[model samples]
Target chain A: MDYKQLQGRLRSNILKMHHGAGSGHIGCSLSCIDIMAAILKFKNEADTFILSKGHAATALYTILNETGAIPDEDLGTFYKNATTLPAHPAPLKYAAIPFATGSLGHGLPLATGIAKANKLKGNDKISFVLMSDGETNEGTSWEAAHFAVANKLDNLIAFVDCNGLQGFGNTADILGNTASPKLWEAMGFEVVECDGHDIEALMQAWKKLAANKNGKPKMVVASTVKGKGIKEMEDKMEWHYLPMTDAQYTAAKQEIRAGYGLEND
Target chain B: MRKHFSEYIERNLADREDFVFITGDLGYNALEGVAKKMGPRFINAGVAEQNMIGVAAGMASQGFQVLCYSIAPFVVYRCLEQMRNDVCFHNLPVYIAGNGGGYGYGIMGSSHHAIEDIATLSGLPNMQCYIPGFVEDMRATMDEMFARRRPAYLRLGLGKNLPADMQLVTGGTQTVLTPEARLTILSQGPVTNNLIAALAKSDKQNSIDVFTLNTMPFVTLPAALATSIATTKNILVIEEHISIGGLGSSLALLVNEAGLPLDKFISLHAEGYPNGLYGSQAYHQQVSGLGEENILRVINSYF
Candidate 1:
């Protein structure tokens, strides 16, 4: 299947995984699926991206499975005791992952360090770091921002998944919302805006902005509804982690299977 | 120690590629010439202490030996968790230089005073705490700290310069007032000088040995030295930090760990200040009972 088909299937699978576990950040994870797909398509490399905002791993693990980073049997044991896929998406819990996740605002600076090492060692592989809009509340994020721009680390790309909700409450109430696009622009980044769910649009933006190898860092402000696929989940804060019930799970599966024409697993 | 350590930084920059000097956007006015000579290795991480520490940690992970410069509290307390987790957890052979210890920033008020650092730092595990007394001790401790690829906290003083060849280092003991008394007094950094001067003014014919603890995580205080100190009716611990969790306490813990006996453990620590202003490096000792008179009083109390 093409990238678009894979992206859609992954979004559907994210909800299904969260259904099995009875818990997940379905909304935020669903929105970032397409963005992850776009970057994977553009980079065309073996090393995988790391989710700095690890809370969104429900969807991330789902995509990793769809891409064969995890086998179908392995996906069944997510978040269970003795299972590698703990709640916050520990990287390489499965073979293909890179590093552990969960603590937000850490991945970009780390990725920048990795990129710098590659540059010094004369390696051409790239690393991507994805974070939620709420993770920007940390000063370390700004510190990393300044360092990356100043250091001229061009190989690193960071995505601020602008789902607009933080753990404590709404992002605006806690830190206040001003334009993120303008903020990144002032920080000396090549900032681009795109539909977070549109794999095609996101892929285009990634190629245009990030493909340039000559030392400018790129950030994509991916605007997306928190819960994208399921009917009641879109834009609902209640669905951030509260899982769909068995009845709701059966209903969701029926809807997904009906529309996609798949043999129900 | 300042001149010697600064000189080492100067020479290293000329010799090694990865060695770098980082400052707190303060206190290079004294070493302008050396800084100019060692331009590439020097980095001023600015007043943002936490950010500077994280930056240092990041740079260190890439095989750079980052010598972070700042006042004691700025280095130790303000970015405490970051220092503990990011720097020590990674064990990235970076050296931290705390220029003003205890009340070094005496004029700046309590905020600048690093009186609480020793308590917090000594327990961080796998790190060395160097509380240098004389300028020569600075070289001895720094030479060891820099040579080993481990994290270290160097608590320094803005005190007097010593003779160039003065050889007492981390491993060796010195004759500060020319050992005349049988009783021995042990202290580190500026406190050592203050303790010596206190004994002289008291005018007792003395054969006391003044051993400066240059390297900390002080291994079992030597048996001969412990016996010498035990022979004395008094053992005084003087530090410019808080009476709680400072040098005296560290020594006490070391003595306990070594199962050595102490006749007396006297601590001269914070008593606020003559003026309430913080970060006053000079008046710190006088105000906090680390002054010569107070130290003498603690010694005389035992006699």
Candidate 2:
């Protein structure tokens, strides 16, 4: 598969969704798009993925649309009143979303439990959870980390989208070194660092983690720009909250096309 | 109550392979047998209640009947959002067993008291709160929780043994005495034990009726309890929990909806740290006006 082309398509869909809704975590969704794409490509039917940082539901919904897990019309209903695709993910609203996780710090513990259950049931299912760097500030994340290590959940893999920015400001300035690889390693996870937007790097990281049978939960600390892909929006705190204006949307589309060499599209 | 809960799990583990128990570093002597039998299936989730609840929700999503156990405050107050969003919203088969409901952890101060657990938990969508009023009611409560296969809260506390003559009505509502009395004293949890003891010694027991409500967020008033309330226009609602959103509030709504006339209604509930003093459970009950003497005083006032 042409991952660069796929990334452009996902970026376009995500921007369109946010633009249509007139509200969403556009930058936050942008930061984790490639990570989601990588996991979707690598994971099997036995595996389960939980979007713990639920503010970025648009990103997950866009990817689910690409996979045909949800109909295109359902994707159109994102962020509308009483829509299944709310600003945060609702459990069983879509086939792939197993838990309602818009609240930060919830996904890791849930992932640990799923991994533990799979181990007890003698199933070789890997539980994957995607979280934001800001979400690590929640105490439950550390608690889950300790539990995952204590129980030796080798079947669990965590992805931290280190976007550097959060709702307030830069994550480091707010909560210093919250989701660092060192912290995860100290918490007993086998940690891997990579460029989050580089789909190949994420894929390689996933491969390394999945190959290990070392009874330690795995973490991928993917360094990423908060508003990746769009030149003006990348790493800007304002993009996290701002929906695109018509002019901004036009410019962003051009940038995405030019960046991925999809001028024809 | 904790012993009965442990016994229920130990007894049912043989037939229920899908059962998984997770505790938030509680159950010192009571759950050791459960741990031994279930092995890896039994999880001591450290002292992290939030993580424990989230874990329970996750396991439940995978078709396991998961139970998360801890002290009432630790389990209910600490991870309320997880309980609401993860467990209840999904309608997962995750049972939260909270020991020491209301002022059961007396002398430990307000932090240990779960005075509002019933209201907070019962308010959530797709969640049922069960307060087993007697030691014998634990098995039936657990059975109902599992049979329903949804999110539930089991509040465990100090409960008296049921006297041989008295029988628990269907749905665990028991009418201890005087079914057609002019005044109906509707109580919840182990607090009903104090009411029963108070009524047994009272010379005017025949003038007042006593009914214990164990399950909360009831869809409708239990048939017999409704009949009693309808016949007896005067009602006294008692609970260890706070007056708001507890049995008192719920029953009041149900009674009004059922169009049962009420000449007078009174609610006696946990007053919290009235004097900011920590003491035994009995002492707290006394201070909160939930003791046997005060209960009898209120029952007698109706006459």
Candidate 3:
């Protein structure tokens, strides 16, 4: 599959969902679209992925819609009461989702447990959890990190969308002095750094981690720009909660098409 | 009883593939043997209650019967959100077993006390709360809870003063000491022993009925309990927990709602947190007004 084209389509679908609902985490969703696309390529009948940075549910829903894991009809009811995809990844709404995670700091522990269970049961399928950089601030996240290391969960892989901006402000200002990659390294994880928007680099990182026999949980710090596809909204914190007006939606659509060279394809 | 409970799980370890015992570094004297016996199935989660709960929930989600155990306060208080969200919300068969109910860890001070756990856990959806009054009762419940295999919370006491031949009740209240008495004393765990001792001292042991309630979140009074209430309009509920939302409060509501003729309803329970009082379990019980003398006084007042 052409992953770059898939990323563009997911970004477009996410924009449409946010515009249709009139409310959603557009910036966070856009930042993790490429990472989600890359990880979806690894998902098979047994492997599972948990979106710990659940504010980016739109991006995951869009990917699931594209990959045929979820019915395309469910995409139209995003963030509406008419469908179970109500702003966060609720597994009850879609059984294809392995577990529900909207509250921050819960996803890593749940993923660690699942990975540990699979290891105990001798299942070879890998379990992946994608989280936000700002989510590392929660104490439970650190507890789960320590737990994953102590248990030696070699089957577990975590990806952090390092978008630099959170709901409050830049992550650098809110979380003082501790870089997420270094922190994971200090906690005894085999850390990998990659360009968040580079699908090829992400695939390579995943492959390298899966091949390593070092018996440590792996964390990939995918450095990304929030609102990657839009010119005016990129890296802007206000866009985290901002809904697009009709004019802004039209302009975003035009910009995405022009940027991806799909305007006259 | 803690040792016995662990031994029960240990004895059945080889037979059951679905059972997994996890602790947050608790069960110092009770669980070491079970841990050694169960091998990979026994997890010591290392003082991380929140993570341990999530881990239990995750394992249960995959069809494993998980028991997340620790001291009373740490097991329920620190990780309640995970229990409510991850375990109860999914309705998974996760058994949250807290080792010290009420003042079980008394001299360890307020941080260790779990005087209000019943209220906290009972309010959650799909949670079955069990406070076992004797070692026999705890043994029976351990089997039944795992047999049914649903979401549950087991509040264990300090394992003292167990009656050898008392017939235990599983799903509702059981009148243990007195059968055909008019004034009934409703109590829980080892606190019932204290009430029995107090009543024995007053020579009213046979005249006064003592009933124990170990099953909750199935708070409906069974026919036997209702029948016990029918013979007696005067009821005194004594629990080691605080009165608010404890057995006392719940029984009051149950008795009143059941429309049993009631001349007097009294609950003898700990008032609230035992603030700044550091002493033995008995001393803490005394400070909370759960002492035998105080309970006898309350029961007398009700009559």
Candidate 4:
């Protein structure tokens, strides 16, 4: 698959969604779009995915649209009043979304529980959860990590969008290196590190974790830059909460299309 | 109450494979039988209330009936957002059993108290609150919660069996003791025991009617209870919870909406740690005017 083209298209749609809604979290959404795109390829009919870092709902919505799981009309309603695609994912609003989560640290525990239920029911279905590095600050995330390991949920795969920048500041400065491989390793996860923006690298990391039959939950410490596709927003904390103006949206779309040599389209 | 819960689960486990019980490292001596019967289904979520609630929501989403067990404050307060978003927002059948409701955890300090739990839990959409007044009510409450199969909270406290002579009105409002009287006493949880004891000794007991509520966020006032409140005109609501959002507040709203006449309305609830002291459950109850004597005094004053 042309992941670069896919990332370009996903980022463009995400920008359009944010621009249309006058919403924020564009940077965090961009940071994790590639990771989400790659993970969706491995998700089977029986598998479930949870966006623990719910601020990135637009990214998930865009990707779901790309995969034909979400209709284009629904994508157009993003962040509007009573829209199915809200700023945060609403539970059962979309078939793919399993929980209504905007609160950080909730997704992993929820995913772990789903994985545990699958295990108890004697199924091989996997549960995937994507979380922001900043969300690790919540004690519930670590508690879930311990529970996942103690239960030996080998079918669970967790991805941390290590964009480093959070709402207030860099996660490194706030939590002092939340994406350290050793931290997840200490919690009994089979940790895999990857360049989060590189689709091929993300795919490889996911493959490695999914292939592991060891009785431990999997973690992908995806190193990424916040606001990855747009030059002006890249690695900037302000982009986490700033909706793109018309000029910025046009420029961002042009930049992504130009990067993929599809400017004319 | 905990023992009754354990026994109920143990009895139902053989038939319901969907029943999953998770404790926040609580139920030390009360849940052994359940853990033994459930095996892997019984999860000791290890003192992580937030994670426990989220986990319960997750499991419930997959067609499982999940029960999350812990002290009232630990299960209700610490994971309020989790309950709101993960469980209640989705309307999942995740039963949260909170032991030590209100001052039931007295002497353990204010941290262990659940004074505002009813208000918080009942306020959530698609959520129901059940506070069993007697040990026998456990099975019925659990059955109702499971039968409804939605987000519900079971507030557990000291269990008191209804006296043989006392009749239960049944339905939404369980009228434990209803004497022909001009004043009606509405109460909730085991604190109703104090009212029952107080009524037994009061010479004016024959002049008052006592009703206990097991379910909260009432969809509507039961016709029978509403009639009693409307006719009596003198209403007193007693609860182990704080003043706001408890049975008192709920009853007041229901009565006002129904246009029931209230010549006088009084609510006695948890006053909290005004003296900044912790002691036994009885001591806390006494301080909050939830004691047997205080209940008798309040009932007599209405006469």
Candidate 5:
């Protein structure tokens, strides 16, 4: 699959699904598609992934569909009451998802326990936890980070889609973001910075961390625009989850297709 | 009866396989040596209470007996939601062990005291609580509970008047000191001993019966020598916890629901927020009082 081409399809699919479901963090969902797709193809582990930021579940389901983890037809059931894809992503809906995470700062702690459990049981399945910048402020996140470091959870890797915006406003404004890198570093873990929109960079960073057996947990901070690939909504918090009208949907879909050179396909 | 539960917990080092203990920064010297002995079973989850509960829930989900330990307000109040949704909702066995219960940290002021712990905790569904009246009860609870129930919360006193040995701690039985009396002084935890002492001093010890309840959740309400409330016409419920959902309120509900018509019943319990940042043991004594002296006074007034 073409990196940019697949991203375009995922982007349109997310917008349609979120709008159809009338729920979700639409902007963040569109921003993190590349990282999700690249991990599925490159990581080559039992392919364990958990969406720590449960609000952006549209992006998760879209990528799952692209990887044939879910049928494209079931995408319509995104957030319906009877549907498996409720407002927060339920792992039981898809085998690839190892756990459910929507309660802020929960994913890392649960993942840390799962990782520690796996180590005790002598399993090497890598648990890739995809989180949001907003979730870092929860004490549980840091607590789990320290646990992961103390226990030397090399089988675990965390990806922070640093989109900079949360529900209330800028993360920096709500809580100063100066000491996160320093805090984690002091806890004895390696850190990496990458462009979230650049699938090749994310895939490469993951590959490097996979080779390091030094027994330290790894964190990759990927800077991203909330609405990447959708020019009209880029960085606009107003589109955080504002439903796209049918006309707006047509226009946005057309623009997404044109952006990735799929106007005629 | 002064039973130091730490000694028992220290002996059962390998039991941690099914038991996971998480703590705040406290009990550093006290718990560290034995905890580290558990190797992978022990975790100092830092001062994050909310996260600690969630981590315990995670461990429980994976088949580990998890115990999240901290001070009362830290574990009971700061992380109430996590306690409710994660631990309680799943009905998993996660023990919440809190230090400085009641006036244990009275010198530490209202902030450290845990007067309302039972009031708040007992209200939750499937939450079994224990306020060990003496060290013997603590030893028995720690020993028997591991093989029986996996999850519970234990409020430990400040080691002031612990049971000198295991004599008083029975295998889940409410110890009876007096029988068939007009006044029944019902209570639990460290404060309960103080009440019995008060009775001994008053010489009304013969007239007043004392029952020490170590078993909790009020489910195992001891079938005592039931004095007909219609004949005695009096039952005084006392505890270190708040009168609200504490021992008094629990008994009241059971009695009222069963329609046990007692002529007079009084709850000699606490009032006010015990979370005083002020440091002093006197603060707890002032707020909750030491024991049955105040309760006896209330019961005498009723007579």
Candidate 6:
């Protein structure tokens, strides 16, 4: 798959879903779309992915729909009454999702275990756990970080959607200088820094980490702007929880079309 | 109890290919054999209880009968939300073996004690609470847990004081020391040892029956317990845990639901914090009103 095209489509779908669903994490979801696109590009049948920052269910649902793991029609029912696609990701209801995660700091530990299980079974499926910058503040995430290294879980690759903002405030304000790359490196991870919105850079990082086998887990600290595709909501805190209004949705679509060179409808 | 549990794990690992044991850097002397035998299957998840539970759930998700071993407080209290979300909510077959139930690690101070574990863990849905007072009970309960393949918490008290005639009742009660008595005293774990000793020394030893329940958070009362409750005027519950949510509270609920009337339904169990008591398990038991003398006094008050 052409990751740039997929990123554009994922961004468009995310905007539409936030507007249609009437409630979703639009900004944070948009921040990780390109990173997720790069992952989906290289993700094989053996590979499994977990979205630890589960408020971005719309982004994951859109990507799954694009990948054909989930039906396209189900995307329309996003966040609607009696819909399997709720505001948070429920993997049991959707086969594309592997683990149900919304609570912060759970994804890495669960992913570590999954990688461990795969190792025990002699399966080489690389378990990918995508977390948020704010999610790193949880103590459990650090525990998993330490455990992953101690167990030599080289098959696990963690992606930090370093959007810089959290639920309450900027991650810098809440947790000063969390510096995920340095933190992960100190915890014995082969840390890589990248522009999260740059699909080529993310794919390159994924390739290097997937092939590297130095007995240390890999972490890609992808620096990103919250609500990256749209100008109005970029790095704004309110967009974390707010769905796009009709005007905001129209503006976002036009911005994406203009920036990504999509044919204007 | 730890010795038998470790022996069982070692024996099972020889045959069961799917069994995985995880610990939070605990089981100092007891787990080395299991670790050596199982190799990579036995994982010490460090002191991180929350991550240990998540790891167990992850292993269990892939057709593994995972066992998480730790002290009662560390496993139950430290990682309750993980157990609820990762294990119980998903209904994974993860057997959490808590080594020090109640005041089993009493001299290690209040932090090591696990008095409120029963109350906290019992409230979770799809969870079975098992308190094994003897090695036989541990074997029987482990077999039942393995057969059932559900989420269970096995409370392992450190003290090994098994009553000579303590019957291994599967998912029910056992009349250990005294049977066919009009007055019944019920409890779980090694606390039953004190009850047994008290009953044996009492003048009304034949009149006061001593029964031990191996499992709790159960639906229906065992026929023997129900029958005992029907005939008894005085029923006393002595647990090493707190009064609110341990065996005492569960039995009260059963008695109320069964509509069994009695002159006295006394619950002699611990209540509130230990106030930084760093003494032996015996001292904690005495202060908590679960000592031999306290048991005899409560029995004499009614019987």
DockQ of 5: 0.29
Evaluating just chain A, the predictions reach TM-scores of 0.90, 0.97, 0.96, 0.97, 0.93, 0.96
Candidate 4 stretches greater than 4 Å from native: B170-180
lDDT of 4 by residue, B1-303 (tens): 878878888897524789899999988788888888888889999978999998899899888999999998999989999999999899999989999998888888889999999988998989999998887776778878889999999999998897654555553234444536789878888888898888789897666767778888855787767777867899999999898888888888888988887889989999988898899888999999999998888888887
lDDT of 2 by residue, A103-159 (tens): 799999999889988988888899999999999999999999999999999999999
Clashing pairs for predicted structure model 6, backbone only? none
In terms of DockQ, the best-performing candidate is: 4
Maximum-lDDT candidate = 2
User: For model 3, how does the per-residue alpha-carbon lDDT over B1-303 read when each residue is reduced to its tens digit?
Assistant: 677778888887534667788889888778878888788888888989999998888778777889888888998888888988788878888888888788888888788888889888888878888888777777777778888787899988766545543466655335464455668777877677777667756755555666787877547876666777788777888788887778878887888788889877877776655476588788888777778888777766654
* Tens digits of lDDT, candidate 3, A168-202: 98888987624377878999899999999999889
The candidate with the higher TM-score, 1 or 5, is 5
The residue-by-residue lDDT of candidate 1 on B1-303, one tens digit each, is 466666767765434666666676776555665567656456555566665665566556656777777778778887776666556756767678887786666676677777777778877757878887766556666778888877889887764544332346445455544433445666666666777678677755355556656666555676655666656645666666676666567667776776756567677776665565444455667767777777777777766
Write one digit per residue (lDDT tens) for candidate 5, span B1-303: 213655566677346567677786667547766576767677777777776787677667657777677877678888776776567655667888888777676666666768887767766766777777665567766665665454567888743344332245343323344444577657677776666556555746556655666556674334452443434557877667777667777777777766667877877666655553454554454455545466556646644
10 residues in a row with least lDDT, candidate 4 chain B: B170-179
Instruction: Report the TM-score of chain B alone for all candidates.
Output: 0.85, 0.96, 0.92, 0.95, 0.85, 0.93
**Model-by-model DockQ, in order:** 0.22, 0.81, 0.62, 0.85, 0.29, 0.56
Let me know the DockQ for model 2.
0.81
The per-prediction tally of clashing pairs is 21, 0, 0, 0, 25, 0
Ranking by TM-score: 2, 4, 3, 6, 5, 1
lDDT-wise, the better of 5 and 6 is 6
Better of 2 and 3 by TM-score: 2
Clash pairs for candidate 2: none
Highest TM-score, which number?
A: 2
Could you tell me the lDDT of residue B193 within candidate 2? 85
Cα lDDT tens digits, model 5, A1-265, are 3477777878878878977866647787877777787787676656467778888888888888887888977888777778878777764457766556567777787667666666665766676788888888887788788878888988788888888888778888988772266667778878888888888889889878867978998888888898887788888888776877778778878888989766543
List TM-score per model, in order.
Answer: 0.79, 0.97, 0.94, 0.97, 0.80, 0.93
